[model samples]
Target: MLKYIMQLYKSKRLKVKHAFSSRQGGVSQPPYDSLNLAYHVGDRRDDVVKNHKLFAYEAGFDFKKLVFMNQIHSNKVHVVDEDSFLVPSCDALVTNLCDTPLMVMSADCAPVLFYDEVSKTVAAAHVGRKGAFGNIVKNVLDVMWERFGAEAENIVVAVGPNIKLCCYEVGEKEKSEAKNLGYGFALSGAHLDIDAIIAHQLQKEGVLKEHVEFLPHCTCCESERFFSYRAQGETGRNAAVIVLEDYV
Candidate 1:
């Protein structure tokens, strides 16, 4: 019984099935409690696997077909198919294969999902400060277009919950790096709006504003409903998953 928060753009688009999972209806106890979908965290492997199965079942996809990334906060985008499951050291995954889900795990880091209706391709990116600074969105879009024939305008982007500016404090070094990357400062030089930065990157990459949807709920602020690494130093992660529907 894994509960999910659906994205309207994904729901309306018939080519894909996508959901951003919340920290609810899971079996993990205490800190990881209820629906933690990541395995890297301290949550029990059995609980994480069960949670994945529950979420996959609820989202109308086979758990076995789900592919996950060993997110390292990098700009690496892995192109995947049925045989290319379980990628290591990649932050983004793209696939045109039907029934294969591309999933990204994040706590405070942003999870961005992409669906290209024209190409019938889907991708998920784990975007944090480093990835965003590295323009991971552009990298993903480039992969979708070059590798899968996806167009920027035809792609619907959904940015799931992450640590917002109100709660995301950054060091001066990070601030300098973000500023150098053209992502402006926030909170009187104390915070960085990584979400806004991601959105801006999407628009810069020629993705229409109307096609980009943002789930503005901050993970740090809404700790009860979503896991936040900033809020809880060592915590479980939420998942953003998308799959191309199998057509007979």
Candidate 2:
């Protein structure tokens, strides 16, 4: 049995069953190189499935119960249920059900996992430039609260490896968009600081500053260990998964 190392946050809450996968530890060919978890990235389908199986097994969760997003870069958030249809058009997922792991896959985009110890709810979101500047985080927070009673103050967030200010250079148009959204402070020259923006959004939505943990890794900076679409044009994805604490 292969042991894939899923990066876990040193959260204060030990019961948060979540992880952020790196590009290592699978059987896909180079570039995709071993663990490429996205099926739409043109890697061999079998290889992608095998990668998923490895991830699930290593994380001690059933692969069949892992729910992921189709991810259109929108602010859409879905409340997942046993039979609430296959969510094929959302960038975020929230669930209070145990053993049902919610996942968000990304390359340069941020994969964020959430755990609310109060409501026993968990969520995963794929956050990119659009989502960082848009309402994706707020939307996920809303759905978690409204549908599952997951309070924002009790929500512990783990922001996985992603593109940060050092590598997140943006265009003038996108810069202007962030400015219009009142997040102009996150801009430093040509680079847009996604982490700062997310932090501000979390604070505005009532998530405590101490409860959030931002993983200090840049995919573009560590392309060898983590997948980076910006670094490799036709690349694979890194996945961030969260289940209700220790359901395996």
Best by TM-score: 2
lDDT of 1 by residue, 169-230 (tens): 88989888877766764324688888788878888889998888778789999998888989
lDDT of 2 by residue, 126-207 (tens): 9998888776899999998889898899988888899989998999999899999999999999999999999999999999
Over 4 Å off in model 2, which ranges? 1-14, 245-248
Best by lDDT: 2
Clashing pairs in 1: 26-34, 26-35
Q: What's model 1's TM-score? A: 0.92
In model 1, state the lDDT of residue 221: 97
Model 1 lDDT, full chain set: 0.83
Whole-model lDDT, model 2: 0.86
Which residue ranges in model 1 land beyond 4 Å of their true spot? 1-15, 185-188
- What lDDT does the true structure give each of the candidates? 0.83, 0.86
